[model samples]
Target chain A: MSEGERFTLAEARDLAVKALVTAGTAEGNALSVATALVAAEADGQKGHGLSRLASYAGQVRTGKVKGAAEPQIERLSASAIRVDAGAGFAFPALDCARDALVSMARSQMIAVAAVYNSHHFGQGGYHVERLAEQGLVGLMLGNSPQAIAPWGGTQGLFGTNPIAMAAPRREAPPLVIDLSLAKVARGKVMAAAKTGQEIPEGWALDAEGRPTRDPEAALAGTMIPMGEAKGAALAMLVEILSATLVGANHGFEASSFFTAEGPPPGVGQLLLAFDPTPLSGGGFADRLEILVNALQSQPGARLPGTRRLTAREVAERDGLLVPAAIVAEIKALLR
Target chain B: MSEGERFTLAEARDLAVKALVTAGTAEGNALSVATALVAAEADGQKGHGLSRLASYAGQVRTGKVKGAAEPQIERLSASAIRVDAGAGFAFPALDCARDALVSMARSQMIAVAAVYNSHHFGQGGYHVERLAEQGLVGLMLGNSPQAIAPWGGTQGLFGTNPIAMAAPRREAPPLVIDLSLAKVARGKVMAAAKTGQEIPEGWALDAEGRPTRDPEAALAGTMIPMGEAKGAALAMLVEILSATLVGANHGFEASSFFTAEGPPPGVGQLLLAFDPTPLSGGGFADRLEILVNALQSQPGARLPGTRRLTAREVAERDGLLVPAAIVAEIKALLR
Candidate 1:
């Protein structure tokens, strides 16, 4: 691969699957993970895309993540399901949850799935988009290892918890919104550090709890929560829902997703599906259109998830331009 | 009453109830509304407190809000309930929902209540706190009359929707969070206008869609959504869930809550309760404590709702120092 290699969506997915399988993942599990990663790339979520493959493979090779572990599902209630990922990659667990939740939600009108003992679930929006495509409203919350501190606290105590929500549309792509509680993703600071660039003020703090623009110090310290105290509170809400309510590891107890560390992250995710037909008694689509029309009618107004949907369309049509270095690194896993 | 007048909690509540009753409200209905309004004052939410009594009484007098309407509850499903507020105040409706939701959540693991044909439900946190006190995780979303424009659009298409969430704790007060999707509440601009003070830039835009610092101009324009586009998206989500799903008036259709000239505001509220004991199989309290300990261990970190709880305690003990003008106005209603 040269400096500017590009691959069709299917080509990139196949390569990812092969690399994961060669690095000791079960073929089926590898395919699921690969499909998600490739979708992320296609949707222009570069950080969550093939760039994550090397680290994932390393974790698998190091036995920090069980490459062939099977998720165990339990029916906690008629409308609630729980899945234990057996310290495996999160994609398979999420897939299992989605299947159960969709069926239950259709019948019960609403259903929830709690997933534990899982690894990183990339691109929360992707999971919800699938449910939205099925005409169900989807919600997802995931807890990661600690990155942001509690409000007014200097010590990191919670993850950069992320929440994603999607609602089905009558004609347009589903409305999707995915946001991290932090002002910005921590990966941006790492990228800045690598490029020897300074971060903006208020993006992060130093070890001494003072704001800093130096990316290195920011990386060593804490990311600033979005909306100040309010964001931290929202992060805590996600932590409690995704971890505490699911009996999974607390953010502080979880290992780093970026490293083949001392143990599997044992993080958790919660997914919910709601049948809008039963809840709204039909006309959900029309009501959604009313809001949508008002939104797009104005200049500069754009719905969330539109960018990713557009990116996906382009990638599906013309393919994705992944970096050459990332392609080589993923291929090296096979060698 | 002079410039500074203090009233005991009972005194304040009694005054509110008497005023409403004098304005033609049923005694029981007046009590419920008074209790809620007095609680708001005690909790330091002046916008929703006794200061709102004048407008409420005027609405009752003008028959904009039915003074003696009885809310009718319908069990939509085993885990879902709906309440028609009978074009009356929202307190009675929320009371009905809370009563039904607690028992249903316990039996069903999770339950939801949607209230329609309602007027303003003040201080959403107050409602969720009730559920949290009952050892349930409470989530509430309410749709108000239009005050916020769609993202990138100057037309006010959605309300400054509010969301409230609360999780129970073992020993500490419940962890509660309530936030409006707007950068600032619309009341602040109104208050500023009354004081002839300029608002901060970025708080709102003028009618022409240009940023403005004049409070009067800000009131005439649309609020800047919190977190830019994300907040508008959230507001839309709330609108769909609370109004569209509940078969209530859309934000665009709802009448003004601050006036007595129109029909009932016909707003809506949706509340969900999750019994953590059943969902988590006990140990819910202990797990919550771990995160609470971590947060409080650091100096300066304080949980949401603590300040309000403390304010309530002080108000109960030392009484509330409300404006003499406001107190006189309430008395005038009785006269």
Candidate 2:
């Protein structure tokens, strides 16, 4: 949907829930995933919002994402937990892990949880924010199917690894940064596909090493590393933490959540929670607030999540902007 | 020294140690710091090598970096420890932390350490390699003086915030990725300045938010975030873990390891080590080696630290390169 279209957040959520239900997702699962997507769209991250529906539906149809699967804790220690996602969509797995992490971190002061054998999880930022909202410092990472080339290689060997973190900032919006290690997220390529536009140079490559602007060609080729080698390096680090360490897929074996091919497409995720009270002597939140204030009040510099929060404030006040074309597409699918 | 000039590795280490000792560092501290710089030069990280001596000397003369201060353990838990760096350069602090962490990780299985009030630690990749060389997976992060902006807005609110990790790969070199969150390391600007070269567009901005190619202007300007916002987010995350979590100076309050102003910089670093033996269930190094070989076998992709290792290898085979100019500079400093 374009920016001009409007929808109440509730309406958008309900519409998405219905769509998920129609696609055979369990009611609770449908509601959960639906809320996640709506939350994304409401905050104007349309790249990950409703646009993910068709791919999610396809995964469900192909049994790549098992909505009814239950994630089971595989290993637990005093301060760490590892989960097997039971070949399910990753959101529920991550949710279970994050919830457990908060409880575990309460006593341990820090908790690290890993989710493996899961399908695609969306918006890592949201998960960190959830922990931050509860007054914990949170960091999240996920490794998808290999989609970015390692430095110097022309083929994809690293996922568009997304890392997110959030720290509470009192009245100010939580200082959250959710980012993919890749130069540009693969979603931008998909966005270009839908818009029939060419991506910028240095963004991607065709099957050969040569750069290509065509989204389709770029996908067939490889996504460029964020800045030559560093993006590749960061992606490798993510793979180790989220996949190799978590005992999930690594390298080319990792399958995309949006694609239904290759062994149910398992992915890996990690969530870390740190109790600020221990570190701050109970003044942790204040220290975080001070840091946030420093950034916000600096001569120049925006808080990481400020724009989203600002957009959210406006959306709450004036209703959300939805693309009419996207709404029409959704309506047609529902009918 | 330019690319083809060579010197034996011993000769390089000897010279560096001599120079550091001449600059007033204690013998042990001088040896360690000199070894690190030689290692960086061997690894082909010219920007981080002997090039840093002038600034290091300046900091020492100003008393920002103590010559002989030793780090002491201030707090210890079964799985964690906090060290006070005693106003010394990071080499001493990190050397102590590494030994302590290795000992702890051997028993605890996982150990985390925070070094507070430390100076600029050298190339992060080397630290991880040290841990990896000891057969452990290592993750290290250090937040320097504020040099990076958050995302939008402007002004420096974060440092070049470097994050690095290393994984043992059996007989293969450990897979390592060490990098700064800023699009370009501040050192690159210094290099450009020395050479009178223009930084590429988009790498930095002038003091007023206008983009600039001049190295001097970019130095005065806030370093641009690495990948638009992702870079900023990573830097902020690093600050929290490496500074706030460790109870050290953060953001603007952080003292410049490269300059003389401000109270002794309370630089902090975080180090976490994981036992791959437990994760791999034995023979993990061989499995890791297999993974490394697979990646290396792929055309074009080089392991992150290979170039440095190669440089060191070549330097050892021949001699370490000492530019006539750099030697002249060092000799001049002795008087």
Candidate 3:
């Protein structure tokens, strides 16, 4: 167990797909979910990667997530589309939205997609990158289960909602920026709680709204929003855009993302795509490169998502090192 | 002069328009500019209010802002419009874009407007609120002259870029959220510098990247971003959306917004409008009220923009208090 196992990207994807299929997910749905998880893993986001399979499988088993459900797409208007994820994995719904957006944005110059009743959307950057690769600028926001309190209150009322943006580069991979509203991801606290560890101060508050370093207390309490009140405000903005505007469950009304209990998460996501060519009159690429050069010329300054790109390159060239225990667990699903 | 002055909203607008017109701004453009400034003052945003009229008039007089330029609008696609601000005041350009967007969004369900070659756009919230008043969800981003540095960089290469969002409520005023990327507005530093006052720590870094309290040194240096690295990243996102995508000057390339020197600033803005009725299938209002109630039910928690609403109500009832010196300054412009 001390020695970890390594798998090529293709092998990892196949292994994940097999495990998901064995857990009763439809083959097409399993493939979509597995691809997203593997991509996240390659980008060094273990919190959203293969680590999520056990809970996901349990949820499917209990019908909290309908493993065979297919997303239904509706053309709401000339430039807007709505997708009902049908209580299934979010990857397929996001894929459906991205596919629709690429063509819609090209035709209309700008387009938007709203997806509801979805599960965990692994690594928001993954969805937006697809749009960038199609020569579009992408912006995405999603609401998860509640883990953050309102700015001055003790009760959790909003998710550590995420926002992501991606733009195509002239001669390189797209520039991707993704961030969670919280000072730190709630997953870090959950991991620390499992390991019986104390979290650093300023990350969370206990149930009485007092700062606490104990992971368990923090888990039962709330994660602190980044930039204090400003971050809390942005979280609420995301909540309204991703959930309320789409008639999906509010953060406080959704089930947990970390457990297989109760109803489906029934969360929602909003994605916007713009065709840079028409928007910029054919100047977007040159202008973007100017800003990129300015950023790179500065000492000690680096573009956002560079680390993720580096991780992806190494994983593609060699293989991803996965913990042996988790690999074994994944294999057990096949048995 | 010893007695402070108070002006009704109409009186304030008239005073501002008179000063601007005396300084050679066209009557139409002056009225638009005065309207925005009055709105800012009513919302308690004094930095963007009448305090800016002297500089605005000076810039107009020097031709740093085109006093007679009419914004030119072109429909780029079914869902996008581009407005050439013609190196004129941003308020007029924003007005034209908003007028076009309300109709476009209603037909397309979502629409975007990109305005370039613009002068200072005061209070990003003001533009978005217009869309919300038209029963559309609105988001706006604008980049100003350079005032912030990239993360870990010593030089200022980005503006105190602002982002604002507004949504209509069921039985209340539209919910508006607006913020600058910097921890504090650069105008506050400018004020402190004029008075020979020191600023608070953590507000800015000296030219050599050392933290400083001296307002003059901070003025020549870069303002610290709101949430450290995350804020810096978001600033870059806004810069690309508002400036680069619209083929306008980058933050570093733009001239000062507060002075009558150099060429026109030629900055840019991006505004997005979504018709909520179709996107939400007629459920947006009820869903938003649910989230709003959840926040208000908490004893200490209040909705965003409540302070601005309170300021507006007071100003509307008792009129805005104008400082004697600023009144004198405006009077001098008339002379």
List the candidates' TM-scores in order. 0.96, 0.88, 0.98
- Which 10 residues in a row give candidate 3 chain A its minimum summed lDDT? A325-334
Badly placed stretches (over 4 Å) of model 1 are none
Cα lDDT, model 3, residue A7: 97
Query: Which 10-residue window in model 2 chain A sums to the lowest lDDT?
Result: A276-285
lDDT per residue as tens, model 1, A1-335: 36667899999999999999998999989999999999999999988899999999999999999999898888866677779899999999999999998988887777778788998999999999899999998988899998888877777778888888888988888888787778888999999999999999989988767899999999878988876766777778788888887778888899999898689999889898878766665667887787677678778767777888899999999998888789779878889
TM-score of chain A of each: 0.98, 0.92, 0.98
Q: Of the candidates shown, which would achieve the greatest DockQ relative to the real structure?
A: 3
After TM-score superposition, what is the CA distance of residue A90 in candidate 2 from its true location, in Å? 0.7
Q: Give a tens-digit lDDT track for model 2, residues A1-335.
A: 24556778888888877776776667777777877887888777887788787777667767777867777874556666677788877777777888888876666666777677876777888889999888788988888877887777777777888888887776866777788877777778978988999999988888877889999998888887665677778888887777776667765776666675556877678778877666544556666667877876866566677678887888778776777667765675576
Error of 3 at A136 (Å): 0.6
Give lDDT for model 2.
0.76
DockQ of 1: 0.56
Which candidate number would show the highest TM-score if scored against the true structure? 3
Q: Which sections of candidate 3 miss by over 4 Å?
A: B1-3
* A130-228 per-residue lDDT for model 3 (tens digits): 999999999999999998888888888898899899999999999998988899999899889999999999999898888999999998999998778
> Per-residue lDDT of B1-335 in model 3, one digit per residue for the tens?
36769999999999999999999989999999999999999999999999999999999999999999899998988789999999999999999999999999999889999999997899988999999999999999999999898888878888889989999987899999898889999888988999999899999999888899999999889999887888888889899889988878989999999889999999999999999887886799998988999999988888999999999999999999988988988898898
lDDT of 3 at B292: 90
Model 3 chain B worst lDDT run, 10 consecutive residues: B1-10
